[model samples]
Target: MSSPTSIAPAARLSDVHVAFDGVDVVCGVDLHVAPGELAAIAGPNGAGKSTLLEVLAGTRSPRRGQRAVPGAVAFVPQRAAIPPRLPVTVRDVVAVGAWGRLGPWRRADASAHAAVARSLSRMEITELASSPYASLSGGQQQRTLLAQGLARQADLLLLDEPTTGLDADSSRRIRSVLREEADRGVAVVCVSHDAPLLEAADRVVRLEAGRVVGAPRT
Candidate 1:
């Protein structure tokens, strides 16, 4: 397994704050994620866990304080926001990861396709590569999304309740996959209300009223 200490700090939020609709969502958060670390974010409903993940993923900018994130980042939202009628195959979705590196004008070459294949294989979804993404079960869809992130070679992976609504077996599989990714030097930050998931993490952060209420401990 890749050591968490092996990779430098890839993300940091110093007293960060975020607000929505005149209400504060995240309040004065001070957090850091090192590469290869499996960090879990736990909090009550409406505690801003999802908001924090979004901020780190660059989907939402912080309203205050300093935020620093480096390298490639891949985010999997709670709902897996994928189009149902996109007409793109499962493999095609995973290949989208290479788009940023390939740029808009260039096409994905052999190396990029190889990465997509490896990612699909790693997630054990190679058999579904040609299938329509919408036809897969919830677990399969989540795995496919994970494969997409892996194909991107993301140094940081921010996941928001990735295991929500999954069966116990499915959830366990997803957790195992995340552990493998962390072992491979991908920083993993997951937000979940599930206590079991928290136990598997190297460190856990708790929040209340959008403020960190407890220090993270291994």
Candidate 2:
């Protein structure tokens, strides 16, 4: 495992601050995800969990502080935003994760094919490879979306409510895959209110009223 000081952070928020219309949503938080670490951000609805995620993903600039994240950051939004009704199959959707490197052509080499297959299998969605994306159930769609993010094998992975609507078995599979990704040196920061996920994480950061209160005792 790489130490926080030794390995450059996949994403780092230094004294970050965020607000909306004169109201403070997040304030003065310093967070960093080192290589090979799985960190969980847990907070209530108004605690700015998703806001921080957007900051790290570069979708939103902090009101104050610096945002440093890898160029290959993969941000998987909640399930409702993930399921695509396009005519593409699950395989096609997952394969798109590699498009950043493989280009838009379908005639990718064997290595690219293997990568897509591996990602699907990791999320236990390999059997749905041929199923149309819109045809899968909600849980199945979530799994497929996860496969797409995992396929990126990005330096940083940010997910919001990743396990929402998943069954116990499905959630376990997803968590296991994320742990494995961290083992392989991907910095993973997941925003979730689920207790099981927080317990399983390598570290948990709790927030209240948009400010980090303290680390959870668990």
Q: Highest lDDT among the candidates is held by which one?
A: 1
What digit string (tens of lDDT, one per residue) describes model 2 on residues 73-171? 777787635345557899988887776555565577787788899988888888999998888887788788788887776888889998887789888
Highest-scoring model, TM-score: 1
RMSD of each: 2.0, 2.3
Q: Which ranges of candidate 1 are over 4 A from the true structure? A: 1-7
- Model 2 stretches with alpha carbons more than 4 Å out: 80-85, 102-107, 216-218
Q: Whole-model Cα lDDT per candidate?
A: 0.84, 0.83
Q: Residue-wise lDDT of candidate 1 within 125-197, one digit each (tens)?
A: 8999999998989888888887888788888998888888887877887888889888877889999877788
Write down the TM-score of every candidate. 0.92, 0.90
**How does residue 203 of candidate 2 score in lDDT?**
84
